[model samples]
Target chain A: MSGPATHVRGKKTLARSILGFVDKGLVNAVLVIVAIFWLVPTLGLFLSSLRTVGDSASSGWWTVFTTPAQLTIENYASLLSNPTITGSFWNTILIAVPTTVFVVIFGALAGYAFAWLKFPGRDWLLIVVIVLLAVPLQVALIPLARMFGTLGIFGSIFGVILFHVAFGLPFAIFLLRNFFTQIPAELLEAARIDGASDWRIFVQVILPLGGPAIASLAIFQFLWTWNDMLVALIFTNSGSQPLTVAIQSQLRQFGSNIDVLSAGAFLSMIVPLIVFFAFQRFFVQALLAGSQK
Target chain B: MTQLVAPVANSPAGGDKRRPPHGSSRRRMFMIALGFLAPALVFLGALVLYPIVYTVVRSFFSAGGGEFVGWDNYVTMFTNDSTFTAIRNNVLWVLVAPAACTILGLIFAVLLEKIKWATAFKLIIFMPMAISMLAAGVIFRGMFQENPNLGVVNAALVTVNSAFGQDAAYPGAAGRDGLGLVQDRGVIASESTVESGSEQNFPLVGIRVDSVPAAAAQAEPAVNARAGQLVGTVWLDVVRGGGGTSGQIDDGKTGLPGILVDAVAADGTIAASATTDAAGRYVIDGLAEGAYRVALPAANFDEGYQGVSWLSSTFITGVIILSYIWIWAGFSMVMISSGLSAIDRSLQEAARMDGANEWNVFTRITAPLLSPVLIVVFVTLIINVLKIFDLVYVIPPGSAKPAANVIAVEMWTVSFGGGNNQGLGSALAILLLILVLPSMIINIRRFREERQQ
Candidate 1:
């Protein structure tokens, strides 16, 4: 009876392994198809951007695979030479960099205080942070636009960056606070016993320990600010419009300027891709941590 | 603030041996914490909290902020056709877009587990989450262009359509003016009736010579009809070099084949029907002896199978939702994938050992385990979708914008997109906030529960 049972178990294991192998292959096949479906839009845009105006208008982007010589950088060259695209590109950097830096600095300080400091209403304040995280920018636009107009900074790059940093704080503080709370309290307590001030402890201990979270927060904020069109559109005029708004202006009602649209869009899309890939490890780590919130 | 600080200032003589004056130190800690938190608090309070309160208050005021007009703005928003359309579209967006993203995310996450190139697949899928919604709008706008030659989507549709043998014969062909054939409601018919055993001719001119089907042969005149039969020819009337006579099936013309011809009797009933052949000629044999009008129905000249009018007002909302799903599904996928990785593998192994198939394990075990993560993603998506503006704003054409309007875009348009009605826009914004509030509460509750755990 024991020998027969063993034989049956061996056959079951072999069959299960075979099933698993088949399942893996099937799943891989579906994944490949899905990946292709997912990549085709961006891929088409990339290929379209590299083609000449006539080629883009005359045929679909995929035809270039058969006739590779149709590919050219003329569109991109013309796009770069256009003052509007280049200026907006510069304006995006101008907006994203300051927003990122300010959010990280203020968020780290506030997040540390929320995590470690003994203060009244701290939990309530953290709850407010969570609530603020859920507050959509639409809620703030009307008043802020008025306020900025009153302050004489409406439609300025400075005004846009201020709003970006302001809105970025909630998630920044929330994510960093959660990460900082997980750090061992004893390390900070030890630093305090040795006469380290709260600022020193935060800079020396919490920042180093919360590096991945802070890095991810910065990336998230930068991307959010960079990709932001609603806020930019509402706030900035044509002169101060970021690449998104600038490119969007060229979108005709009935006809397409495919050459200009594709190149400008690709240029806007490439920066965040680079930033995201470069810090993908931290990005993923932050995603997992932030998901729990 | 001074009440708390006064104790520290007055307690210089109250130092204890071990704690170094607890009240003063605690006060210092509070002050330090306050100092640390002040900057973020100021921004949050000024930009987010204050603006929310101000928006609510301003919603009750007049457009120029001069008068307290009570709920007039809210009533106007509810009554206004555009704003009402915006609200309805927002509901549709919240219903469709998030659910699509969540479902697609689940499938992608689950499938990624069994694939060897999971990381690469994930990267490809998640790549869109990095690009701006404006850029995505441009991509999808380009993708869904009406012209098949330019848009990849329409081009693909045209390819599959032709591969399935569903090409239109002649989309825009028309009869020439002063010709014997008269067109009405896209159907062309002879001006006068012909008795059976008589011949008819249809001279079409609108279709470009080159645009005619490749299989079309040179124009042919109808053969003389036999007894009790009607014969006819339908061919491109214009000659290639533009010297052909009106109503004549001239040289260099080709047949418009596969066109349906009807022989309608005087009683408004069809006595016989025939389809044109490759040489544009048709024979209706065994017809009754009464006079019949040879007619071509509307189907042959239709703007046939012009790929889907995706950006039309009717389909604009759906197209915007699709683009939203395209950009956001990867976000949910990455989130759910993280949750899946955290799930214990032993339960799935146990289910497999018990002879449960992959589907059963997935449905009965894996999905149940991932419910928490799924709820988070779903609620997050709900909140996100409620505020969707960019894709909604940018993808649709000017004509279709009203159909695709969401609350966010409506608010923008009302305030900034030339409406200049800040009061109405504020009310719309407040409406959006109210819509998003429930999900935010659910999310906050979940966070509180997680914190307690």
Candidate 2:
């Protein structure tokens, strides 16, 4: 009886292992297919950009695999040499950098206040920030556009950056506050006992410990400001338009210039892709902080 | 737990009202908090709060803000056809795009659990999220072009059709005026009947020179009609670069190759059919001796599956929504995958131990546990889609812009997109705010719940 039971157990284990293997195989297949589906369109765009305009227009992008000699970098050369594309690329940096810097600074300060500082209506103020997170930026565009006109900042890069900073603070503060509140009370108390003021403790203790959160906030704010379009569209005119608006303007109704668009698109995508991959972990951490208890 | 510790640390000086130091400490903390919050508050007030208030006020006034119209703009928003179309399209987007992204995201997240190279997969999928909507718009617009030579999608479609031995039709061909053919919609048909042994001449015009197939031969009128057979010539009547007689197949005219011609009996049945060759000549042999209408069927002028007119009014919204889904599905995947990782594995393992299948375990144990994250992601997408402007503004062609308009784009158009009517735009803005408020409330509540947990 014991021998038969052992044999049966071995058989069961073998079947289960086979099932597990099949499960893994199935999962990998789906993942691979989905990954390919997501990557192919961008790959097609990139490949088409690498080919001459006539070659790209005459054949499907997949044909490039068979005919490698058709590939050329002329599109990229022309796009980079063009003054408007390069100028807008710099304009994007100008807008993104200032917006990111100010958002992080202001967000950190406000986050520190909400987390550690004891003040009248602190909870109410924090709630306000949380609620503001839901306020679509569209609601503010008209009034703000008009106000920018009055302040002589409409259609300027400064106006665009200021709008991004204002809109970015809510989520930035929310994330930082969550990070800051998790700090042990004993750390802040010890700093106070050492005669450090609130400002000193924030700068010395909280700021240093909140590296992940700050990194997360900076990455998020940077990506948002860099990829932003609607605000820039309504606020910035031709002189101050970012790469997004510039790319948009190149889109013609009939017989669109695919060569320029493909190259410009690839160029615009490169910086954010770098930022994303470099700080991917921080982005995931930010996602967890925002969603997790 | 931290909340419980916070007040105790602040009250270390004791609760005695008589202590001057304690009162001073509380006041000092308040002042410090205010100082820390000052810059963010100023910007938030000036940009977010004040603008919100001013938009509400502006919505009540006339276009130029000179008169107090008092809900007149709101009335126009509901009354105007374009604005109404915008509202309807926004509702469609809200109903479709977010749900699709979330579901796709959830599936990708769940499937990622079984793979070794999950990180790479996630990165590729999430790569689109990094691209600007403007770039995405451009990519999708180019991809969905109607011409096979210009658009990747149509090119693939044409390849597949040809591979399956299906001949493509000439969508651009039409009958020349006074060619004795009746034109209905786009299909052209011979009005008079022809005898079986008689020759027919189908002289068509309006086929663009570049659109002509490269294999097409020079047009020649058919001659030497055989008995009990019908012969015809379908050629481009217009001659390039010079004057040509109308409704006549003159020299230098190109053949309308590959057009399907049919001989229809009086009972509306096709008696015989033939396809034109390179020289625009076709012959239907063995036809019964009867008068038949030489017809060009609708398929001949069908525009021949130009791959969906993605930028056309009928499909512009769908294309925009598709682009939105592409960018956001990766975002949803990453968010939900993180949530999936946080889920307690023991619950799933226990369900499996009970002899449950993978689907059962997932639906019963895993999905239930992941609901909070799913709801958070879904609501976030809802708010995001409500404010979607760039894709709508950038993706659709000028002709389809009105058809694909979302509230955000409508707001811009009414005020800035050459409408220059700020009052109505402000009303549209407020309507958008009201539309987004419910999801925003749900998201905040979800955040509060997550914090509590």
Candidate 3:
């Protein structure tokens, strides 16, 4: 066990036991239990939404197994029929799409500069963006709310979109800049030596290469804007509130009306889930890259 | 002439035609970069940077934003109970939620190494990371309902308790007024001690007729007790349609079944005890020939497990933290798992070969090696929890909001949750920034260092 032969054996055994900090059986059991624990709440929400108000109020959701036929789509039907919720769904799309578009456009443009271009104060400017990433949105809420009101756009979807774009730029720029830097500098310089102007080089060179980062950033911004309640709550009027704010109103009013609340919650959740699952590889990759740094 | 002409073409200002002078070209590059960056910079300056500076300045102003009041809002914020509660709860969130998530994540990351269905399990755990805090709040709020019938948590607790432990037979049951039995501290005891060979009757009232067990039979009067024995009957004295004697069992009166009856001697020890039958009759067959009090212990009428009032002021903070951990633990796990995969496994193997057990290897080698990843996750979580608002706002009932308050939610409340005091709100916002700045700086430094490396 003291020589090169043992060292090789150690590597093989270590590969097997790298995860074996405890008994394998105990580890498996705990993992399964935790997985179940993580799953139960979301499962409850889905099952509870399908249950009638009376059925839901009388027994826990797991009891639905005893009488599975009682599950119905009425909650969802009613949720869709409600004018406020339906309108808010449209408002969410309205807010999210434009915000995503704007963040991507601006994030890509600035990210290109920070990545390939030489300028005075560039490093310091990048540092400012990093610091801005740390500032919580709370600091801006009061002043911006007042500013939006003075601009006569308060309580409108446009104002909410504007606010999101503003707050989202730091992170967008940060992520895009980092990702753009990874594009080989020689490629951009070669394009430049061929007489392509900076703008043409950005459009023809940087944007194509930065596609995955831009998509990831777009998905992140869209989901964030779609799921946002705080910004919409302050900036949008009732008429223009997104699904989050709209559902929040339902939560406050209905309290434990799981029938209505669960339907609304699942509705708000499903889009992000779809987007997330569709691009989860990129999403997780971006998260790992962004956070690890 | 060609040489002179060529010299002039390439000399001084002529170079500006083919390629700009160095200083001017540098300035031109700067202009182009500025043009590209201006939109984002403008938005950041106005929305992010300017608000930060404005908030700091506005903290000194009045609620109406008119009169200058130096340190008044800050003073009030520090002294106010709700603000203090918010600050204290923030400290708790900062302390507990991040560490819990990070630890749980590390566990999950390590555990996933040997598991067969690791990808599926990882997906299930990480699913919540995609969810909004608002939806997560709704999920948790429903999961922690106080009623066992509704709340899954309480239902499981109640089921486990009933299977292995005693639950109160009649929670919230009480005795009739002016009856021979007295209700004291949830116990219904005979007002007078009954000697052996005598009967004691407990005719309880106040239980709704519908709540009476369906299996309970009509009340039957207790039979005469033999010498050295005690007998008793416990029945629901109230009858439907309001036609029953106040302290006596009447027609259609149902028995309170499964209630424990205790006979305590003068020394306060239980001489004998029996459970009431379907007819509410209990016979303690071999009691000592001494006087004993026929009483129902508090357990008989105990309110049993109503589950936890998770939204109550006492537990709301914990509930919110639990939800935060639920949503965030996966993030930590994913990060730590990446780190785990990137580490050298032979070091752990060597340690194990040197007689270090699994736990020792994990603690000494694995954990110490993973510290960089762990610190990143921990600091990121610390920063995340400091500004947590959605679950705290949406999960707690309005009654428990003060207990669940953190600086972010407090700032919102003071400004727009009907307080209409943006000045104090700005003060709170600044305070939050102050609390969060150190973590931010650490993260930025780490980011810079990572970039350099």
**Model 2 alpha-carbon drift over 4 Å, by segment:** A1-23, A55-60, A253-256, A291-293, B1-21, B168-304, B450-453
Each model's C-alpha lDDT? 0.84, 0.82, 0.83
Predicted structure with the largest TM-score when compared to the true one? 1
Candidate 2, clashing residue pairs? none
Reference-based lDDT, residue B218, model 1: 84
Which candidate wins on DockQ?
Answer: 3
Off by over 4 Å in 3: A1-22, A254-256, B1-21, B172-195, B199-224, B232-257, B264-271, B277-281, B286-293, B353-355
Q: Which regions of candidate 1 are displaced past 4 Å?
A: A1-26, A51-70, A189-195, A252-256, B1-21, B162-168, B174-182, B189-203, B218-225, B232-234, B237-253, B288-291
User: Could you tell me how far off, in angstroms, the CA of residue A262 lies in candidate 3 after the best superposition?
Assistant: 1.5
Interface C-alpha RMSD, model 2: 6.3
Under CAPRI classification, how is model 3 graded? acceptable
lDDT of 1 by residue, B313-371 (tens): 98988888989998889889999998999999889777766767668988999999999
lDDT by residue for model 1 (A1-293), tens: 11112233556766666666777778778888888988899998899999988887778899998999998999988999999999999999999999999999999999888877767787789889988887889889999998999999999999999999999998889888888877765566566566777688888999999888988988888898999998898899888889998988887632458789899999999999998888876776666666576
